[model samples]
Target: MKDLSYACSKFPAVSDPTADEVRRLRAEEKLSVRQIRARTGLGRNRVHELLRGVPPPEWTRRPNAKDGLRAEAVELRGQGCSVNDIAQRLGVANSTAYQWIRHLPLDADEETAARRRAHSKVMTDARWAAHRAARDEAQAATHRAAAGVVGALTERDLLLLGAAIYWCEGSKSKPWRRQDHVQFVNSDARLLGLFLRFLETCGVDRNMPTYRMSIHESADVAAAEQWWVHTLQLPATRFQRPTLKRHRPTIRYNTQEEYHGCLVIDVPRSRELYWRIEGLVAGLGAAIT
Candidate 1:
């Protein structure tokens, strides 16, 4: 590299370029500040100050109307005009408007600020309570609606529905000790009936095996089994024993109580049937969408 001092001495410095010219050259030619400084032999700081369109440090400083406009910007922010809107009204950039308004409080007086904060707290509380109430009501409505439809399924219907539910959602395969026995495990007795109806639709034999119940460890396992046996008119010998999973505090087992657990249905020839059912589901989705 050439000695910068010698280069500066060789080229006598002219008046600094105008800010408009600097910006235009930077945009059109994509020249760096260092490149401009090297070519003109101007000091790096001087080049930067010129590029920014600010006066050099030697120039006297004075607060002007622009400072007053910043105060107006703060007032407008308190009134809820967004930074972009304020910038447009003041003929300044959005970033400059934001910088002016960021430190100012939303309310000018202590009383007004406190009142606004209190109102915000009340509104937040109301919203949360309303949300929780709505969620509970919706869950109750679902339970009621499910109850109405679940009581009418016959034993054959239950078996077929259970089979279909298993085929769609359960883990099953011939290689994995062929789960040929049909079992419908659910905490909700009503939903169990619906699942059994779905099984009947799929043509599963009702007499092949009796429906069994399984629930979370926290639930009344024996009571749940008895409910299933009595509701379905199955003999005690036909009722398979219920399995209870241990409860963990961190584990979210909402489905264990509410949703019917995976139904183990007897599908003696399930490989081809599984694919057919999958294709039917895919076709239905495509048709509906």
Candidate 2:
């Protein structure tokens, strides 16, 4: 009623309003003194003083331990405490404790370093000797076992069995070779018996009618067939006539009488059994090798 604008002009323009206006605005608009300063563009300190109230600043200050503590942390690490023990005392992670310890001296006394070097060398040598002895024993045992088994079979049987094993398990298969049956090529009788026994152990029926044989042309083919016939109790019809390979002068032919021949064992759908045998062979290979 008495000129409110002129009365308000007594105070600074950018500063807060008078107490009467502040009370009137607080009652009318329901704003705190800090909220009033934000809406009216008034100086923070002047607004609070004019409204007869105090307001805290918007930003907060955080406290940190000074460098004095870090220096002490480093000193504690040099006194020979382990990283775990240090971390526990300092209330820090093990990695942080290790970081502090890494700054310490790496040097140790000559006697202490020499003892560590000697101990390490001795342990390494002992481990090597143990492994060497085990390897030699395994090799000797494998050779003896193979020799005993092969000795029981005739020389012809050995060659045939070896050839069959090589064809089936050996890495000699070519893409052009159409023959998919299990074949072995070797002159060693003991190896042949071993292969047969290995097959028998893999659930191949001893009385299965699918068993067959084939031999080389150079050797006594009839005798070879008869021997397998008597041994496996199969008919002569199961034996395939030998395939003769002619000799060449340039090709080094060490064809000994001992080179009995090769053999082919026929079984319909033998692939499944072949896979099972493969797994069995693989398990034994580590010990054999």
Write down the TM-score of every candidate: 0.35, 0.33
Report the lDDT of model 2 for residue 38: 75
Worst 10 residues of 1 by lDDT: 258-267
- Specify the highest-TM-score model's number: 1
Tens digit of per-residue lDDT, candidate 2, span 152-267: 65644544454446545543324696433454444445555566565565555445424334444455766766666665555566555566655444543545644445555555
Stretches of candidate 2 exceeding 4 Å from the true structure:
1-181, 206-218, 231-235, 249-259, 281-289
Candidate maximizing lDDT: 1
Per model, how many backbone clashes are there?
Answer: 9, 13
lDDT, candidates in the order shown: 0.62, 0.58
